[model samples]
Target: MATGESRARSIGQQATGRTVLKTHPGSKTAVLVALAALVTGCGGSASDTAPTKPSAGHRAGSGSGSDGSSAGTVGFDTVFKTEERFQQALPDPASMAGWTPRNASALIEDDPEPAARCAPSRDWECAKIAHGEANFEAFGEEADFDITAFVDKAGAGEACRKEATWSAKYTKAPGAAVSDVESHAYYRNVGGENGLYVTMCLGTVVAEVTLAGPNSSLDPDTAHSLARQFVPRIQKAAAAS
Candidate 1:
């Protein structure tokens, strides 16, 4: 939801190779939008450019028994049936030990302009139809993880894949293998603190999770372990829908 001069300034700073300041705790959507703009806008510099093609990070079925879960594809009508159902499918920090969570309002990109802003592109390859996100902070440390589930039109997983790939490249993070789904992982260093970002696509849902903090012991293994639990819930929700 960050627009006007502030949004422009965010993108400009990223383009010019400046350290992107950590946004406030409440602006998760704005942070995601700024990240999308960073990948699309910073195509000139070698370090800023993303791969034109997706990496073979991990290949598996769309929650169809690969990860020992039977969640499969559902129609758009089912997945987008209601906003509450979508929100209910998101990751719950209560399930994770010692983590406190706050959720943002679910976003539905029903209009063209907002959809365009979701993933800036002439062809709109990375736009999402709807998304729900939450931020979770550790009980007594400067560490946290943010998880978001994005739903796209039926059979449009490729768009979600593009967004994940661009994000990984922008951070110069390496790909990691996640079981039972198509996924990518990247290592991130924000303000000299280490973090991990992992994304997986299941059916029409793209689940993104980021873990960061200097004091936190979270790593790729922890993130992937959480995805193994959280991704299946999303898949089950879609199948039920």
Candidate 2:
């Protein structure tokens, strides 16, 4: 009886060991799949949290800045138009008094075109005189004169002279020397606002005249009528320049 029992126990133990060996490979594969799932879950969550970049079109409107506040549209055309209108308001040389007739050869001399008939001295020249509508440009020379300072000297007076304003001097060519010759004067009919008289030193002469209507008290209707007639001609002359 004891021998039979021992043999049965040995058979049971051997069967149990064989079953464990057969299932070992499948258990390892299951554990590996679970580990792979855990790693995939962590990776997918990180990807979802990443920040997105803006589209190219959106970035362009934001200008060239990290904070998106530096870009805008510029109105270059409007600025240019304003400048053109100001230029058009300037006076013309042919309409001024003391100016000679249009003569290309006369300009070759050291004398200014209007001064051709007058004596030529250092900074001393003559200007032609013309009146109508009161928009004209007179040409002459000045010696040792500060035009800007002169205009400032005039201050807000109705008729005074000290220095010339930028509006008066900007039209001339560079290196065109001015002299002080009190022999010349700048006159503007002003069309009733009141007239203006600008007198400079002897070597200084009147170069241009831009009338804004007579003095302030003049008739507005008459001034407007004159402006309408004169502004067109002045504009045409400036355009030729």
Candidate 3:
């Protein structure tokens, strides 16, 4: 459960349009990345479009609840088999090349309130059983990296699409990717900093890669490539589960 102050901050963020990330004993880049998904955190409206017909990489079922809101779920266990598996799924320093990981290890969250407040809407705040994230800082560059994966309940393709569409609407981003998988890329300014937020869904797993920094050399294309690179990794991990 969240403390009163934490809950208050959550409400404040939604009500006042002011984003505040509670201090974590993690790296600075992690804190900054939390702001990247603030506006579209967990809760989504009923108006966004939901994909009909089961898409590849998503389980078949109805798109959303008859109420036209995000469909609820009973949730899942670790999306990855374990915390170690979740960490192993993230891109390493060698894979990232120019970026050096800042956090001592991936930050894993099983708590609902904070992640529900910090992640993108389709990332499914409350439905996630485990959320793992890591931060990296570019060598001799202003860029930073924040990537996350979620263990969410399966069968919410339409709800997830609805949430993603809602977030894209606010970011003025293009629609979801037209591929065998369900994915999206959004480039925009959040909390006054420029960022590219790319996300994908494979079964019960949701993955997001965000590149953000003030005066950062990173661009939308870089984030897009990273998301693409992560796809197979996430698929393998989800398969193991």
Candidate 4:
């Protein structure tokens, strides 16, 4: 595990915020409501009723269901027992119609630290969802590093700067065994690119999601909505192991 300052710097560079737009009840059409309620990371619900294939804007999930048909796989599925299932969590451009992959490898899935990265002993399983526009990743491993500290330090402003030219954007909610499992979100923009990052520490897993847009100013309401949608999915991924 990385030590105090080292850990802070490592996670600080890695983890980070929320402002969002709200949907008005005055909206008439479902399409209008969905358009109003934006999300950076796209996927279906965790329930059994959720779609097996990736949703409209999402580009994750793989393989066929029990009925010999391709199922839309998005988010954390309890059926992920093998490495194939884990690998299937990765996004494929050709898998979806009218989908174009510009820069898929821009978001990395490996540990940030150079020396103390995930080794064989650490036994880490990482799944990343990245596109030219956004980045999303999930990490599952033995209790090797202190992820709780990462979350706490991140929120305390000891890790990464809450106000990275954007603002102090965070999302938290009650009702969880682990206090930090609630959620933490922040945003930053470098050059003409704007990115929104949200991190969650659950069990021995740390799930991170991000949105990178070409514009300098991103929609806070969209980031908030994405964070809210993704936090539970991260929790489910952590519990799958």
Best by TM-score: 1
lDDT order of candidates, top first: 1, 3, 4, 2
lDDT of 4 by residue, 1-241 (tens): 3211110111111112222233324322111011100111233211212123445554231111122222322222232222222223322222221222222212222223332342433222211111112222211100011122122222222222222222333333222222334345565555755565555443323344455544313334434444444444334333444
Regions more than 4 Å wrong, model 2 = 1-217
Candidate 1, superposed: residue stretches over 4 Å from native: 1-70, 73-78, 112-126, 139-155, 168-176, 190-193
- C-alpha lDDT of all candidate models, in order: 0.45, 0.21, 0.43, 0.28
Query: Which should have the higher lDDT, number 1 or number 4?
Result: 1
Report RMSD for candidate 1. Answer: 14.5
Per-residue CA lDDT of model 3 for 84-165, tens digit only, reads 5554455443344334444312344434344445344444444333445545554323232233334444423433664586
TM-score of each: 0.55, 0.16, 0.53, 0.32
What is the alpha-carbon lDDT for the whole of candidate 2?
0.21
lDDT tens per residue, model 1, 16-36 = 454334344423222222211
lDDT for each residue of candidate 2 in 9-73, tens digit (9 for 90 to 100): 11111212332211122122111011111112222332222222324432211111121121111
Give the worst 10-residue stretch by lDDT in candidate 3. Answer: 3-12
Separately for all candidates shown, the number of backbone clashes (residues 3 or more apart, or on different chains) is: 0, 35, 0, 13
Give lDDT: candidate 1, residue 127. Answer: 42
